[model samples]
Target chain A: MSDLTQLTISQARAKLRGKEITATEITEAYLSAIDRANPALNAYVAVTGDKARDMAKASDARLVKGEGGALEGIPLGIKDLFGTEGVHTQACSHVLDGFKPRYESTVTSNLWADGAVMLGKLNMDEFAMGSSNETSYYGPVINPWRRSRLDTVVMPTTHQGDGGFVSAGGTRTARSLDNAQLVPGGSSGGSATAVSAFLCAGATATDTGGSIRQPAAFTGTVGIKPTYGRCSRWGIVAFASSLDQAGPIARDVRDAAILLKSMASVDPKDTTSVDRPVPDYEAVIGKPIKGMKVGIPREYRVDGMPEEIEALWQKGIAWLKDAGAEIVDISLPHTKYALPAYYIVAPAEASSNLARYDGVRYGLRVPGKDIVDMYEKTRAAGFGREVKRRIMIGTYVLSAGYYDAYYLQAQKVRNLIKRDFETVFAAGVDVILTPATPSAAFGIADEDMAADPVKMYLNDIFTVTVNMAGLPGIAVPAGLDAKGLPLGLQLIGRPFDEETLFQTAAVIEQAAGTFQPEKWW
Target chain B: MSVDLQTVKRVARLARIAVSEEDAKRMTGELNAILGFVEQLNEVDVSGVEPMTSVTPMEMKKRQDVVTDGGKAADIVANAPATEENFFLVPKVVE
Candidate 1:
């Protein structure tokens, strides 16, 4: 009866099954919402209006026949990174230049098999590089959240008799001309943005470094980067083979758990995909986390971190303690080496993984005198600045003479980082606790960090280590910042032990409460 | 450890990515900054530490040498930017 746009996947599934609300109604609600908000948010790069209605119509027929699947009639946004048959499945890079995939990615195919209706492809950082979505050749997806101007003293530039700072008359984060915009964290930014803005129920996303978690944290959505091999890399575009993993960015922890269950499966194609059965992660969630050892890694308490973030971390620790989970201060000494090692390892692997876009088999191609000239010309025209920077860095690190010093040494440090997590986990630390990011969502106008590459790289400080160790991590929106933006607390778990992560994340969710932006988009 | 103009040119050539003279100058500064940040890794003691290629300890799963699936040349070449009769077309190399 009311607006169906904001309903979570699980909630919508129940309503659709019960016939209280038809899938068409919810799908139409989201489509109309996209019509209203997408101009400002730029979340959905392509909206499949006809496909969604057809799927919804088919789903209603299935429901009438009692032949619905797990995610029957649920509309979802597929990240551009995931291949969808006959859809515009570019990885938000100019390099891929308007090419649609003839085959579906294993992850999307799995979701479709479960009867999920497709909304459209969402935006992302180019080839899943960059923390902010700015590197996308399609342009950055502006964050829906903005710094509330209610408390700020806006200094007037006009002639004022007194030297008093004036106010801008109680402005909010509306999509007005005067309001400054913040960025939804990236490469999974569009997925996070869509979920938060109620564009789709839940969107598929992948995390190479902090892509999934950081964006979810910034947008106040829940995102989980499952254990490395939990989801297959089969048809998804690879950024870094060992580091990239697909996950769900959802409105709540339960919805994320449900999506992950269907999204994860062992495929014959991906040899690295684990053969273990997919657990009903939703069943383990909301189970009491009492007697669980939650490790508070002292290394995450980095210098120059905002006071509010430190306070939030302490609050999370206190909440866990109150819930009867033991909060112990543990040491992850090799944590400092994580970002450096990650930058090296990710780009090195990316150099090889991204080599397939050589103007040969697929995607864009520019003509030249010879094949070599064609490759150089095409790559030069195809890739964005950030993508090129990474390719060059990757080429450098993996180059002769420098390989052993940069890439090899980084790999050794990677081993030490993994050892740190293993040591803590071995000592009976069930799940580790830390701030999801150093701070809240940043203003898009703050291009100072973007200009300086390393400063932008620091945003991945707390996140890269989990990828290095190949552990599961989840970002749960705990509270809002002083600027009235959402901030999240992360829970890192042992390898393939996503059950523990879901269980613990549920506790954090229950304690800190759910967060959603004020719907400016 | 130093990456000068020649190193940038060398790597760009190696990677098959064409960079303009202006872009090369800017890229050199950016690359230098990134290298400086990663330089912190050199300070750590990684003596006797084996390089980690993957997170899991499992070795690559082997399979029997047999053609399980093939003959989908049409499907394989469907996405090609340039192709003729299922063969990807490139500039003539011998000439």
Candidate 2:
């Protein structure tokens, strides 16, 4: 009862609707903390544990007939780019090897019709193409945050029973720390290392650029993305369809506003979703963002950025000016051509949504001497070398003598980075702030980001101008560096304003507080 | 605006994907360092900028020439690597 994987999905939906915890004991305490931290955080490439205990025994018979639903028996995870009917939806790509869909991914069928539960899939950045989930083929996921060792020794402990801590004379070992292995930032690096190592009570992610807010600002947690047709990319996996969307990564900011009010809706098989109406974003967290306005931008203070990400962007602009808001420095001047115009419109729409992986229909296949040498030896043995350097830089920027010099001059520098956030939210901005990832989580094949691919696409330079201005961003965490890691910040909003980014990331998560990774996974 | 090694082996043969000759000579220096970092959008002037086409401005939601869906031919070849009746088998293109 003390550590059902440290609760929070609105405290395990109020102890599974007050029957005091029985959605199969928080789905066997997140399947025994994902069987003891999934062999050091490889973050669930698939562990449906009999479909999460038969959907936590049908959410304990719909919580004994009170008929529950907003994430009924919680559990979550899902980001191997969504799909999940037969499970393993492979965007973690070995060209979808061993694929399995038979449908189900209108955002995990709207989080399994709101009763949630799945606890599987979760590793990404293969098709969702890297920011740093080390372009996974179900391999590199590890960041249960490590880097903090100047010969560490912090004994005094005492918080055990799986919320971690231990020592107080229970025989040493409270913090030896530094094992190196950093990178949790990514294509939702396994949903920010399974929600900062609690092993999932909230997961499902996807972004496109800044894949779910730079892996929820490198594993501190709380993502967002939304507002590019606010969710419903009809079953996820298709990076850069005008900067992909889907949200949630949780562990605060009201469990990412109750998992984006049940992973947003409006489908008709995704005519770019947005049919509107999705607000109880956990009823706007703490609600009073005083007189709002926020903004700050000054071209996101970029150059060499890191005085602890400009002292955590001046403590998230002094915690949203001590919650009474109105900060305003503004300017967004096409923010450094939004990461070289999002590496030319996300590899020119990832070379036409990866030309539907050409091995005739489904997953992998490599035989040749015909059908264009079996679609060039099954996409050269099914992608990965950062998906063939983004399908050869999205087929040489949509070829034909460089489609008007790199995809229509990177879509007119993505319409001047969406007219510099529509002239700062048409002046009188209600949310912009910045600094999500210019630094903080690194090292996992980090040799200057494996010797440059635009230095790992400049880790989405402060979250790709909110996915090139379709708007609504987020990120959160906002502090902790000098090697203790976790930094975050970013806000952005407007355009179906994700409730002013969960009411200003709950006032910078109530003044930079909620960060968790000390449990050396 | 770089990309050489014969335009990275002709854009990996128009992205069908195989790229050898030493991975098209290391993807012609990683596609000329991502086309020299998107050639910094040619120092932006975007002459009367427009190109965005749709990041959200709507008006494209058409739907009428109905069919709606189809009888799942085995859930669309279930995950075709070689299927037969459910169709997908390939490799011998018109020869």
Q: Which candidate is the best by lDDT?
A: 1
Residue A299 accuracy (lDDT) in model 2: 76
iRMSD (Å), candidate 2: 10.5
Q: Candidate 2 at A261: error in angstroms?
A: 19
The TM-score of predicted model 1 comes to 0.95
Report the C-alpha lDDT of model 1 over A54-97, residue by residue, as the tens digit.
99999888987889889999999999999888888779988887
Q: lDDT score, residue A503, model 1?
A: 91
TM-scores (chain A) of the candidates? 0.94, 0.37
lDDT of 2 by residue, A1-521 (tens): 48888878887788789988788888888889989989888988889898899998998899899998888888888888888788888888887898898888887788878898887888877887887787888788988877775553555556777778666743333335787798887888988898889888888888877888888888888888888887888877887898889888888889888888778878778887877788788777888898888888777787887778887898888878887888978787778888888887888888888888987788888888788888888888888888888878877777777688878888888888888888778777888888888888888988876877788888888788788888888888977787788888888888887887898898888888898888866
Docking class of 2: acceptable
Candidate 2 C-alpha lDDT tens digits along B12-87 = 8888887779988887887787778778778888898888888889877878997989998999898898988888
Query: Once model 2 is optimally superposed onto the true structure by TM-score, how far is the C-alpha of residue A431 displaced, in angstroms?
Result: 8.1
